[model samples]
Target: MRIEHLAFNVTAPFEMADWYVAHLGMQIVKRGETGCFLSDKSGMLLELYEDAAAPALDGFSFPPATFHLAFAVDEVENLLRALVKGGGRQEGTLRTLPSGDRLAFVRDPWGFPLQLVSRAGATP
Candidate 1:
């Protein structure tokens, strides 16, 4: 079967969803009372679910750390600047690989790690 979408738990679904839309230019494919479904111009989907019950997904959890999500980006610098301006913290520096691809790790306002990736030869 083909992978359809990814759903992530966050404290504020709308706020985090809008932040992604604003930063990465993804469209809001669908909106619900508890979360939002987002897709890029190519239609890859991500779901943001509001879960106030628990925020941390450390090793002491069920979902586990391997379930983390990442969003593709064109230019990591601009996105990092925008996120910083909007109160998001930089979890790590620009991690550049030998292939010319780069990635920047950042945490949303609610403390969820959001990975922004840019591959080699990718247009941003």
Candidate 2:
């Protein structure tokens, strides 16, 4: 079966949703008092739920070090810059793979690691 959607437990659902919209170009498909669903128009969806009582955890604990979300972008550098302008922080420098693909990592406002991959010469 094909994948459907990914969900994130965020401290501020609306803010996180807005972050995705502003930085990643995701559009809000649905919204509720406690959560929101965003779509990138490519059959991929993201769900953000508010967690007001979430406990604070040390790094590499709650989310686990291996958990992360990746998104394909038309331009990795532009997206990385936009993410920083939108309050997200870049984790490290961009890298070009052997296949000539470029990738970069960034953390959302609440510290969710996200990978920005370049889809150069591909339609958005």
Top model number, TM-score: 2
1-124 per-residue lDDT for model 2 (tens digits): 8778887776778887887887778999999988999998786888888766875322234342366788888788988898888888888789998877888888887888888887655655
Least accurate 10 contiguous residues by lDDT in model 1: 56-65
Instruction: Give Cα-based local distance difference scores for all models.
Output: 0.75, 0.78
What is the TM-score of each predicted model, taking all chains together?
Answer: 0.75, 0.82
Q: Report the Cα lDDT for residue 85, model 2.
A: 89
Error of 1 at 1 (Å): 3.5
Least accurate 10 contiguous residues by lDDT in model 2:
56-65
Give the runs in model 1 whose Cα sits over 4 Å from its true position: 51-67
Q: Could you tell me the TM-score of candidate 1?
A: 0.75
Off by over 4 Å in 2: 51-65, 119-124
